[model samples]
Target: MYSKVVMDHFKTPRNVGEMKDADGMGEVGNPVCGDMMNIYIKVEDDHIKDISFLTFGCGAAIAVSSMLTDIAKGKTIEEAKKITNKSVAEALEGLPKNKLHCSNLGADALQLAIKDYEDRKAGKVRPPARPEDRHEHTHGESCKCPYCNGDVNAGLEFCSHCGKEMNDSH
Candidate 1:
């Protein structure tokens, strides 16, 4: 069952749609659930001046993206970077256990967008966005652990750095 807050957001999700001239953008998907989220942010003076999203998923995923934009808007880059899956879920008044991954996608997308913004500010050239390039591993040949963004070896059941259970969809 969804919470009232969750239902509210889902019914009338805020900040929905694409931003054509976004300063940064992030996209994430859950292969298992077929959930996808794209977040766009406009930054100014080290703050999130505007934010929006386009989500293709269940109600929970849509709500999470809406809440994430509400939470990140107007916050400084540093503050927005600290937004997490737990926080987004909590803001939604909690998601179903099965739908918690929706929160992860929302948070991860936000962080990735912020990272993209910073990267552009530094004049770092990045390749065109591609499905295979969604995640950039900091550790060579290792994927990032969704729970902690730590290095995770392929086919591992748990993250060696964070000790969290790994889901194949990540």
Candidate 2:
């Protein structure tokens, strides 16, 4: 079952496409569920001037992607970073319990986009992909996220859990 807000967003998803000149881009997927999301952002003077997304998922995923963009537009990067899966679901009047991962992926995608933008601005190289979940690998690295004091790997661009940049090298 879906809430009215969820249904509305599902049927009329907003900002539902790729951006050609995005300042930042993020992509995330759930292999088990076969859901994927890509978020694009355009920043101007430290503010999110625009945002968009492309999602290969269910109605909940599409709806969350749309809502995530709406929540980030016109906000500063820091403010946008504060957006979370919980807030996204709340914005939609709450997603089905099982569909909450849709909101998680949406928020993660946006955070990753911002990390990409910051990395580019600071002239940092992207990390090589690893097979394991970054969230899991972080625990073995024995370091904490500077922003949230949560576990993170040395090479990660951002904390998998809190979305905090893992280091200041960038």
Candidate 3:
């Protein structure tokens, strides 16, 4: 199941709309399940000064989006990028296995949004579409956060599971 905060967000999400001039924006959706979430970020001096989300799906999706925005605000771009699905799940106690993918959607959306922001800053290629547009994709690629799951990324100096420092990168 989900927590009270999770449920509250699911029932009545705060900041559940879009920003006209958002600094960063991310939209994550699972094509298989048709669950989608859109998160918006307003950054100030490299910090996520304000955040919000709009999700069109189940409780897990709404909860993850709500929790992600709460966690992302006030964090630097680097720190915000480090926010993982595991962390979001932990913040909500835990999510059912089937619902676990919701965390992945949330994390991925946030990451892509921040990436979009960074790209804009560096004059990189702008996203092909608007930030809120739903792009179809599979889940669970870099989805595993080894710090809480299994093994880390290959050649990772730190555990991909726990994010703990490791002696060897290989």
TM-score of 1: 0.76
lDDT of model 1, residue 10 = 97
Q: After superposition on all CA atoms, what RMSD does each candidate show versus the true structure?
A: 8.4, 11.2, 11.6
lDDT of 2 by residue, 77-144 (tens): 99999999999999999888889988999999999999999998999987876766433332345676
Tens digits of per-residue lDDT for model 1, 33-53: 578899999999999999999
- Clash pairs (backbone) in predicted model 3: 146-160, 146-161, 146-162, 147-160, 147-161, 147-162, 148-161, 152-160
Question: Could you give the candidate ranking by lDDT, starting with the highest?
Answer: 1, 2, 3
Steric clash pairs (candidate 1):
none
- The sequence of per-residue lDDT tens digits that candidate 3 reaches over residues 77-142 is 889989999999998888888899899999999998898788778888774766434333233443
- How high is the lDDT of residue 43 in model 3? 80
Model 3, position 87: C-alpha lDDT score: 98
